[model samples]
Target: MRVLVTGVTGFLGYHIAKDLLKDGHEVINFSRRHTSEVDELGIETIKGDLTNYEDIKNALRDIDAVFHAAGKVGMWGKSKDFHRINVDGTKNLVNAMKEQGAKYLIYTSTPSVVFGKDEIKNGDESLPYPKKYLNEYAKSKSIAERFVLESNGHGILTTSIRPHLIYGERDKNIIPRLIQRAKSGRLKIIGDGQNLVDINYVENASHAHVMALKELSTEAKNQGKAYFIGQEKPVNLWDFINKILEAKGEKPISSKVSLKIVYFIGLIFELVYKLLGKYDDQPPMTRFVALQMGTSHYFKHDNARVDFGYSPKITIEESLEKIKN
Candidate 1:
């Protein structure tokens, strides 16, 4: 089998590519530019943008399956930019896959799609997309996930896997930024530090992707559905943050801030950033971040397991052992 992984340079994308390769499948990396990781993998790569239909079609022409993982993700960004990449880009991929007669599409989605300004305890795929989103990233991803799921039939099998707070080795975004913020005294515990959330090990998340894809190839029961993948259990949000900080030799974030205050501050910062056109700069706090940090959001993957045999190959304890300060 031949697989094309978009955003192969990214953390999850790289893992997905490696998993596919390990399974004896030929992997093609899709990205805007070449990276050392692709060179290390020594596989075929196509330099392309998801926004370009020609690029997508060219890459998917001979590909058997696709793992769509590329997108602009952050607490802040222009709505149009996010729409172009997350929404429009996914549309282009679906269309190109249909045109190329690709067999399967496993889209990388985020749990934030269903997370609004509320607490979700042991949530499942039965949860509905929030009618209103506090950030553009979540809203755009929601749209993109819907589009991918809706484009399910007609010679293509599409499903979405939403992984939350994914972190592990070669993580270019989550942990490093977290450590930096902790060192700078920018990170803090919001609420009572009792908010529970799901954090995914990179290996486990990659395993879910592979298992789900194989299930699609075999049983085909998971098409047009979404599944949440994460550690087997949810951890207290602040406790998890402190554990990472401790592992990195940084002081644990002990300062407390009110969620309401931070949310208001975030509102002001968002207004200022939008007015100044500083779309690239991430504010220290945003309403979405505040809600995420201060709320309880964890999901159950029983459906994924029952339907596709999706299981985390790496446990959180095993994953933490591999992390170095």
Candidate 2:
């Protein structure tokens, strides 16, 4: 299969493309910028912006399937910016896929789309989108997810994979942020510190995409459906973070703040940032951040496992060792 992976420079997308190449598929990377990974992999590359219809259309010239992994991921940003890249960009890709006759589209979605300022235990594909999203990132991704799923049966079969807290080797964002905060003494437990959360290793999460692509059929059973992808088990959130810190030879986070206190502080910071017109910069605290850090949001992957035979090849212990080394 000639697979076109958008955002191939991103953590998940990069790993997905690498796996496709290893499986003997002709991989075409579509990204706004070239990274060392692309140069090293030496796969065919297309420089394009998702927001541009022509750029995306041209890149889909000979593609058979698409891994639409590009998205604007952030806790804070201008609503317009998130809409442009996440929602509008997805619309453009869908249009291009229609025009170019691409058959399958696998989107990389987030569990935050269903997060509504509450604990979510063992969530599944049946979980509904929140009445109100905790942040703009989730809102935009939700809209984009709908666009992709709703587009299914229009000659293109599409599915969304919602992977939570993906982490492992070559992770440029999540783990590094944790280490930086621990070093700066700014890291603190937001709640009672016993909340459980789902996490996915990069390799396992990327493999889920491959499984979805192979099993995607025009039949409704697999088409237009969304699946939760994660490790086989959930871990206590604070315990997991502390383990990573210990692995890095750093002290674990000790300071604690009640959720109510953090939520109030987050509200204040949000109001101040909005008043200051700091649209590009994230506030130190926000309601979304508070709930995310303090709540339990784990999910089961029974649907993904049964529908596509997806399972994590790397255990949590092995994943931690990869991070430590």
> How well is each residue in 130-208 modelled by candidate 2, as lDDT tens digits?
8888699999999999899999989899999999999987888988999999998899999999999999999999999
Residue 76 error for model 2, in Å? 0.3
- TM-score to true structure, per model: 0.98, 0.98
Which sections of candidate 1 miss by over 4 Å? none
Q: Note the residue pairs that clash in candidate 1.
A: none
Clashes of each: 0, 0
Model 2 TM-score on a 0 to 1 scale: 0.98
Candidate 1's TM-score reads: 0.98
At residue 93, give the lDDT of candidate 1. 94
